[model samples]
Target chain A: MKLSDIFKKKNSGDVAKDRLKMVLVSDRSSCSPEIMDRIKNDIIEVLSKYAEIDQDGLDIKITEMETDDKGTKSVPALYANIPIRNMHHTAK
Target chain B: MGEVIVITSGKGGVGKTTTTANVGTGLSMLNKKVVLVDTDIGLRNLDVVLGLENRIVYNLVDIVEGNCKLKQAMIKNKDNDNLYLIAAAQQRDKTSVTPEQMKKLTQELKAEFDYVIIDCPAGIEQGFKNAIAGADRAIIVTTPEVSAVRDADRIIGLLEADEMKQTQLVVNRLRPDMVKRGDMMSADDVVDVLRVDLLGIVPDDEDVVVATNRGEPLVGDSKSLAGQAYMNVCRRITGEQVPFLDLEAKKGLFGTIASVFKKK
Candidate 1:
């Protein structure tokens, strides 16, 4: 931890807002953790046919993202970060 | 026909009953004929909050079961000539009243009163379902706390799923001092996170407890800040454009200066 962090605590209101933002994303999507797991497995199965994926480095979550440049509206978006090791060369 | 509005919060102890009592009383004070309905059933408290507990000869369950007429179950407010209350049955559970019954009851009440305000119980269960079954719109109440705001978000999703699209929010028990100190979320913060139109904000005041203890609504007090806030909410409900209370004004000179600087 930084020395300044020890002396200055984070504002609790900001903390609450941050927490609610993350929590509401999944809540608004109505996607349970189990459903998310199933979705991740399905995506991995599809992607594995095309590339060698680093499964251990995969991360996926539902979050809110701005839909416009003005930031006036936001919508729940699914974000997935998957590490690729190699691509499969297929011949028909 | 009158409008049916349900006052609800998914979590308990966020002042759903108090808001119902005060808003109902405030609407009646505006010369609108209003009736408050407590749909909590077994754990009912709206009647007590309105100070009409002793006058309840019948209740919602009794009326639905045909044991009493709708008029027999409605207890008039002691102070307001236009206000009345339909108390929930203390002995019955949430399952005792079905959504169909509540819808019919609200329809009948709508024909008679200018406003029928329902005090919905906490939790997204049968009680919540029954409360919003017949309502034309909803007023969701939440505090600045994380738990309350979280529950309010969940309720908004549920309400939207049910196609009850006309929903407004009221942030209750807001401590402006804490917000100024950056320790508590402001009403604007909550509205931003919840993504709903803000109806009003009620400051945390001791007068609320005093008024509740006396079996009187704070809106009748006239001197209380929370009472004035609730009155403004009632006026807004009637399509009146009212400015929100300047909560920072209640702070001393030092706070006013701090707020001014913060705005810049």
Candidate 2:
């Protein structure tokens, strides 16, 4: 079978493959996506407890991107970004 | 210098104990003073595999409890005078021994022997934790099945978490014919998933079963194919880059000719 035929995104099986990749990444990193979501939620809760923070401006995301190697594909490393508001918020 | 190695797999029945017994015997055959420790506690079988089960008067728990000295618990291998075994307490579970005790025992063994191989129990619980606490390196055994590979990967992750530096893979019970027919995963396929250095591959040999049933490890049996593979792994462990054994069936001339034409 051709590689393209096996890996096409619209093949429906590709969804399962992607899910497996996500799961394997989480396993390799020793951090679960479920736990990461809980952590983000708790951070948001703590921010709300202190003051009114703009929820729309809050951005929490975790991503994995592979770096192109010299004629070889490399393993993807995890990246997480969580934006927090500064103490000096403009007074309403 | 003595090195402490642990053989472990997160899944059961992946030949962890068999690997430990054979490798220990192989190392001992090389004139290296080797000791095999069964950390499985209640599920202990290393002694049986080494044909020293009947000689174990004092178990590992006895040594840990101070009822007996470490020397008293060790059963010397009659076949290889340099090899010894510390049999686990079949009556007691893993909690009976702590990681501290294992560390102290391995430390003392290090002073006396050249290699200390521990057969870790299945799972990621206290037995696994205690087995790896004193290990300098690890050898993970897995079959060609997906479940075995997945569990081996989890065990590797745990070993990494403990900061166990060196880890190698031993693909056991591999059938090369099945791999060629796509009925089973190839050694290379499993290696890609685990991403670990390949140590050795043991074929699905019936001699292994006969040896195990006779309470003798395959290491000393010249006719056993698995025995030769275990010896090769022992040489590799001793810093020798021995060529991997050709356990797979040789392709026919037709297949070879086809491959040559495809390359053209």
How many clashes show up per model? 0, 0
Model 2: CA > 4 A from native: A1-23, A29-92, B250-264
Over the stretch A1-92, how does candidate 1's per-residue lDDT look in tens digits?
Answer: 79679546878888888788777777888888789999999999999999989999999999778999998567888999999998888811
Per-residue CA lDDT of model 2 for A38-90, tens digit only, reads 87778777766655656676655444455665523345453534354654344
Best by TM-score: 1
TM-score of chain B of 1: 0.95
* Best model per lDDT: 1
Candidate 2, residues B1-264, lDDT tens digits: the string is 699999999999989999999999899988999999999989988887878878989988999899988888889997789899999999899899999999998999998999999999999999999999899999999997766777898998788879898999999998766666556777887787677999999888899998999888898566766888888989999999999877663334446776899999
How close is every model to the real structure, measured as TM-score?
Answer: 0.84, 0.76
Model 2 reproduces a share of the real contacts of: 0.03
Deviation (Å) of B183 in candidate 2: 1.6
DockQ of each: 0.71, 0.09
What is the per-residue lDDT of model 1 for residues B1-264, given as tens digits with 9 covering 90 to 100? 999999999999999999999999999999999999999999999988888888889999999999988888888889678999999999989999999999999999999999999999999999999999999999999999889999999999899889995999999999888898888999999999998999999999999999999998988566888999999999999999999988876765658788799999
Q: Report lDDT (Cα) of residue B252, candidate 1.
A: 54
Error of 1 at B137 (Å): 0.2
